[model samples]
Target: MKIAFVGKGGSGKTTLSSLFIRHLAATGAPVVAVDADINQHLGVALGLDEAAASMPAMGEHLALIKDYLRGTNPRIASAGKMIKTTPPGDGSRLLRLCEDNPVYDACARLVELDGGAVRLMVTGPFTDADLGVACYHSKTGAVELFLNHLVDGRDEYVVVDMTAGSDSFASGMFTRFDITFLVAEPTRKGISVYRQYKEYTRDFGVTLKVVGNKVQGRDDLDFLREQVGDDLLVTIGHSDWVRAMEKGRPPRFDLLEEPNRRALCTLHTAVAAAYEVRDWERYTRQMTHFHLKNAHSWGNERTGVDLAAQVDPGFVLGEGLAASA
Candidate 1:
């Protein structure tokens, strides 16, 4: 299952995502974590030093990634012709979680935590060189391309730390996830992004759940309940353990607070349940919808080809994936 964690900046979405990834890895689950956020702090949150956290970022190697995923698909004449929303066709490469593949081998890093390990990938951080020259979406597009070609199934999880606010709506990346956990604090500013995201994704059938962070007491919980209503899936109160991690003294997963730990488990359970409802057809439709939108918008002019041709009418993600497996 592919899961995304999104919310306003400073709302603890990154922290929550790291904890959830650790929870899954410690349970011996097959999981891959992608840091698609502009801040790019998930590696540090996952207990990797700044130096060790750095890897072959997807954005820095976009052409290589595009070439690997395009594979033998006749629709994509060249890697340069493939845009971010280009969906997999009959011969396009499809990736499985934790599998040995060119994409993962080049861009992913193996980080051992408690019971198991997690495969980590980042969208590459925005740098001074990108100043006034590049938009963050260019980096984020690598993640969208990766998701477009990925074929994850049950018993596997791909948790993404997306850019803050409604930025993901700029591309089809928001529709790529099986579930999206919107981490919100109780403040008005915190839940404001939730409202925007809800409005943007309401018609798309996105499974958007709210995770209340830094709840002080009943008042905060009441505020979240009153604001988000039934969309609130779980609440995680303040944790000293997380604070310690923030201070640079990371602890083991077993030492996390029981209540917070339970909250993580609840998130895992909710995401796990979504695998039963995974709809490859809907996924393909979403990809095509955004692909055409982009092609009409700028992808056609940018690549100088009819990008709509990239969508394969005969390709069924579920059927193709099963046969490949």
Candidate 2:
């Protein structure tokens, strides 16, 4: 289960990425949360302290990772080059003000595998230099090799949270992900970005879905979901998540988690079934009925959502594995 989230900035892309990671972590699913966004908020979402990444710095860092793999000890790797992201006036100012080697403290927390899920790497948020010339420059072939090591070598699910714009720097990486979630807010331009991004997918065997995160209403939900394909459409709402960001605190899944958890579970199951339904010939002929079953399952869960809905409904709502997961 390799998952990635894409959407314009502030569309809840990072929040969903973190929520999914938290869920998988709770359910014993090992997950790698890749913060590919240049803004780099995934660490903030996960409540992990990490340094702001400069592409120049990242490119420099990659050189070290490669050299270290070859038995060279680079001193800069230990010097800890990093910067502060927290707004001033916060109480944490004194705790880490002007600290060097901030990378160690302000870096992606490789959360251990607790159950089966692990949020191994939370990354991205590089400076413009990372996007302008250096990130694309390819660090002596080390970047590609390092990326392959992350994608090909992972034994568990990997989730990538990419930068917000088009031009394919990050979207090009979509080909390797097992499943892709195209997130959109209510604006047509947002959905349009998702549509264009979808056109560039060249890889086969990867499933794509649309997630309507933080919708203000149902019209947008139905519009996004009705795009006419086998992909799953998951919708969530505006949450205390915004408040959490303002306060620099992590979202307690217990506090701001959504009613859509079961829906996502159903989605994960649907995707697995869709994958193993095996017999593309049979599936093509039967996809409508298959999709309709999923639609029914999804519809039931969408009916009752209050920021405070109890968990009892989903327990009865689950219908066993979509086809035996």
lDDT (C-alpha, whole model) for all candidates: 0.89, 0.46
Model 1 clash tally? 0
- Write one digit per residue (lDDT tens) for candidate 2, span 1-325: 4466777877777877767767667665455566656566776666545442222223445534433322211211221210110011111111111122222233334554223334333333344655666553232122222232231222345567766746333322444355677777767776777777666653344466777766767777676666524443667776675467547664455554456666456556644554443233321222222223433444234433221111111221111212110
Model 2 lDDT on a 0 to 1 scale: 0.46
Error of 1 at 87 (Å): 0.7
Runs in model 2 lying further than 4 Å from the true structure? 49-58, 64-108, 111-124, 128-144, 150-155, 169-172, 202-205, 227-232, 270-325
Stretches of candidate 1 exceeding 4 Å from the true structure? 319-325
Candidate 2 displacement at residue 217 in angstroms:
2.3
